[model samples]
Target chain A: MVDHVGLLSAFGLIDAGYRQAVQVMEEGGLDGSTSDPDFLVATGSEELRADIPVLRHDGKLNPNGRHMAQQPIELILLKQWASYLALPVWLIDDSGNLLYYNEPAEALLGVRFEEAGEINADQLAEHFHTTRLDGKPYPNAELPIVVALVGRVPSHDTVRVRGLDGVWRILAITAFPVEGQGGRHLGAVAMFWETHDS
Target chain B: MKVTLWGTRGSLASGGPDTVQYGGDTAAVELRGPAGEFVVLDAGSGIRPIGEQTPSGTKRVDILLTHLHMDHIQGLGFFSPLFDPEIEVHVWGPGSTTLGLRERLTRYLSPPLFPVMLRDLPDVTLHEIRPPASFALGSLTVRAELITHPGPTMGYRIESPECVLAYLPDHEPALGVAEFPDVPDWTSGFELAHGVDVLIHDAQYTDDEYKSRVGWGHSTFDHALAFAALASVKQLVTFHHDPGHSDEMLDRAMAEMSESHDLEFELVPGRVGLTTCVD
Candidate 1:
């Protein structure tokens, strides 16, 4: 009989409990030769590893790692492009918690995320509202992360909250939903462009 | 050489007990240079006293005016020199908006405003001025610039070998478009008056009064300071005092004028017969 569960374990797909199943499959093999099922399972694991890349310390893919890792060339290019364009880019989860922010975002907003483990978007908006020169409420509907989480795609040139050193600044915001592995919706990535008024 | 004011009133001359102390005559000043050469700035109601002071003779007179404002031109008919045929008075002023200089003077000197026409005046010639121009008479070089006033008015920068004096009697600092971009820093008149010995500027209102009377073609003392400081003048004589101001009020205003930055210029309120040597 073909032991599908044991084949998946040898390919590093199953959990630790599947180790006995893999031993039983090896004993059943008459000449201890690799079968078509085992070969198919190994090939599937290689393909899966190739499709999802692991991030390195420098935010690029580690090519020399033992695990099959795909290069995050597109993500690295996006970060570089965002910085070059002078746009603030940030990733936020469904609960409106900031997950990641690019260099431009730190420069424009004047917020350092080096020591920050978690950031609440609503709290940040509230703080911006109180400190802004115009002294107006920041509407949630106008926030890019808010719109993206609610499954509503915002139009281009939408203004977002931006205040720096007692001066009011205008920002254009856009958001896109990010889908991770297993078709899971990770959250949204928001891009901001600050416009200065002379 | 000496320059003495006989009248400094503007608009309609208001003569009353309150105005009598300052001699409520309309704009007139007598400038006497060396070799007996003399000129008058304006002929307002103040010309009566100036006429009384003129020695009885056939001496020629020169009269220069900024405009035909009633207070500026009214004294022409009353001046004693125009009555003498041998006096040879030469009257100069800014050209009229719709009429020539002669015609404009004629309209005022004719029947409606006065009994005599300008043409009938004996030996008096009216010359229209092309301002932002300069002319020389004896030892004095009189330069006129287009100043901001109700009609076209000219601010004069009279230079003698001894000293330079700038006279902007009816200036409105906020009038017209300020050619330069910055407010409180740039002034067209200040550029024309840089480094003068004395600046006689219009101080027609206090800061409080100026708020209600803005665009009335006059300036306050604060506006005067901005220009005077920029010009680096030695002495700033505040003139064109508002008719409503009292002697006590003027004293207070003069006291507060020193609160400005150390520009090393003396601030003095203008009064009739207040004489100072130009040099």
Candidate 2:
């Protein structure tokens, strides 16, 4: 099993630039400020006016840039840890669209990353509605990722998902809803696990 | 109101010396309502004897099944009343995914499984219980709650003018505990069984056995005791003894269960031919 704590630590490293920007805003007397980017642009506050963009080398962010501020180093380390963990994770919107998925998710769902790219959470929910396997209709209320995005916290339970191989596999899907400032719904993070394998 | 144990064996029926004392019949319970109205719990093997004893007449036998576990419905094939042209039997149970109650029962009672088909049986009506609901038979009121089990099993509460008896002979408390977090607060089953006169519950496993078979659709004697205490029931009869337990083992279990709970309720190990009056 991949160490979850180590994986989280790696996430912190990979998103270091984003993390530092947030920290700067928090410490630069911008705490509790709800000014939009347009408003900030117009105001031209001296602190906010100082824009810093990390330079990139090829596809990766350059670690040794004057404006990089140690964030890129942390980001690279976090990405390395996350990739090593091989976690089955995905990002979905409130309307149940698949926004992003990791490599492990592809293996768990038994679909090619390219093929799964064409499908989304809404399509999956629709498929569940019309499909009948093992002589039982798929329970709509029991769908984990959908329930999470729709803000319905289901009790901890396992749901059966049919794989491409025509074998039914139980999956433990946990949804964590993401909320922004003023509790504005951002999206949701979903984690899937094979029941027996877990 | 007389409640008779037509069948008391849990799981499968055992006919040898080991089960002779408690009676080897599986899951059938007959409740005689006011004016001698018959309310059969399950049609397990015990129903064979009940069918033999119930006089052949144009009387309607009301059969209420908790679920369609083989041991619970196996005796339907041998229920002699179905063959009697004068008798009209009403079978009520939960519906399966694809079939209604009658259809599901017929699947088991028909050709390949049985020599006699259900459609060919004389004067039988089947009702499928879909949601949690109630019904009235004469003056008695029957209420059912969908319980947590592998299949769609239900716990029934029968109320009359004089007494209230709650029968939940096949339930696993942990399943309920998992669904409703406030289960320990005595909310769900207690609300239905509150102040009942007699609470006959599923006590299939001891506390030790429950640890291994947590979600296997059976409850321990401790869980039953706690429920009876929460419901403030007058008497608690532990039904559905694990097939492995002998008469002597059950006696020891009852004794161990009574030591921890300080209540003025009678704790009895249910036996065949045992009769109790509700009123």
Candidate 3:
């Protein structure tokens, strides 16, 4: 339950890194900064259709995967790290709220968190119908993300998750637990890629 | 009854001189009843030869598919019977929870992946058949039992008055012991193959290969041997040959397994043209 406080900004590391990402995104789509790895934030900058909300009421822009008190230094860096990359990144608090995601993920979710307001995991699960690569559904409890939470271990699963567009894209999802402060559990993070996108 | 191994290769169809002896065609097996009835086990690349040599009398081709994996259904569009106006192919297979056999087949058989759609194949009629059930599809009494696979895969037991032949082209017996937690132990493999005239079981992996690939839905030769022994099958034809295994590799495997085990039944290597009398 211990979320390491201000590890990134206290060192002026990810704060500078993240703001630079937003700046690059604002300039143009992902193509603007080919030199920088995080330039992918630029790809969907025009589409989110709203500013990154300053909703500090619960310290989350949206009720993402889960809710919790603080963001571990790893999760903080994770948030910044996800903000730049091209693949879809999703982070949850210990309480299971959707905390942060990059622009590439915004395109897949159908509703960008910026304009759509705060949405919880329950809401996001609605957009996805999880199944195997051949379109066979696993019992919800046995799904890879759920299994990681139960096992407290990192897990990789390959399944097709359909977004709101009703297009079932085969995604390889990797889910891992976030640990901080003498190995206290914070939450989980997942990075997913549409297999066919390659 | 007569059983012919049209294609014995698993996963993918690999061709070359290396695989020519056992054949590189994927999953199709031709079963002929003494009544001159025709039944095809799967539609793997092996079905191509079937299309070319198919007899004219039986216009209705009974294709009992185990599951709709690409390797199992890859040769569907290329099959010659589908192009003929008079021939009717009755395709039978298991469906996903929501999708019927038609919907599942149409997923791959239609445009983008293939130029022809299921609707265009007017002669082919798809039927959804759930296992833990039995049905008659001619003189043959067909019993479908679900197997330990990654999906809703069924290993069939085709019985005639003369004898019974069980076919499990792709199965993971060890997985039956550990997975499917919601269900009780899966003994379908044993139930289907037990005391049967012939058992065409999946022998895609070696003992070492099975260790790392536990849930891959295919069995090692050792596991297949042990299973066949326990079930007391009269004849064991190790089917679903791994694509990477050359003919020499298969011969070595057959010899190795034969010499290694003092078994009750004869262990035979499944070759493309190999035919066994189901008596």
Give the interface RMSD values of the models in order: 39.9, 27.8, 23.7
Off by over 4 Å in 1: A1-198, B176-186, B259-263, B277-279
The alpha-carbon lDDT assigned to residue A114 of candidate 3 equals 60
Candidate 1: residue pairs that collide: B43-B75
- Docking class of predicted structure 2: incorrect
- Residue B91 CA error for candidate 2 (Å)? 0.2
- Tens digits of per-residue lDDT, candidate 2, B53-75, equal 99655388888898899888999
DockQ of candidate 3 is 0.01
RMSD to true structure for each model, in Å? 30.6, 21.8, 19.9
If ranked by DockQ, best first, what sequence of candidates would result?
2, 3, 1
Tens digit of per-residue lDDT, candidate 1, span B34-81: 656678877777776777677767477888887788878888888888
Tens-digit per-residue lDDT, A70-131, candidate 1 = 11212222333343555678766544555447667776556665554335554454445321
Q: How many collisions per candidate?
A: 1, 4, 11
Worst-scoring 10-residue span by lDDT in model 3 chain B = B178-187
Error of 3 at A188 (Å): 30
- Candidate 3, which segments miss by more than 4 Å at Cα? A1-198, B176-186
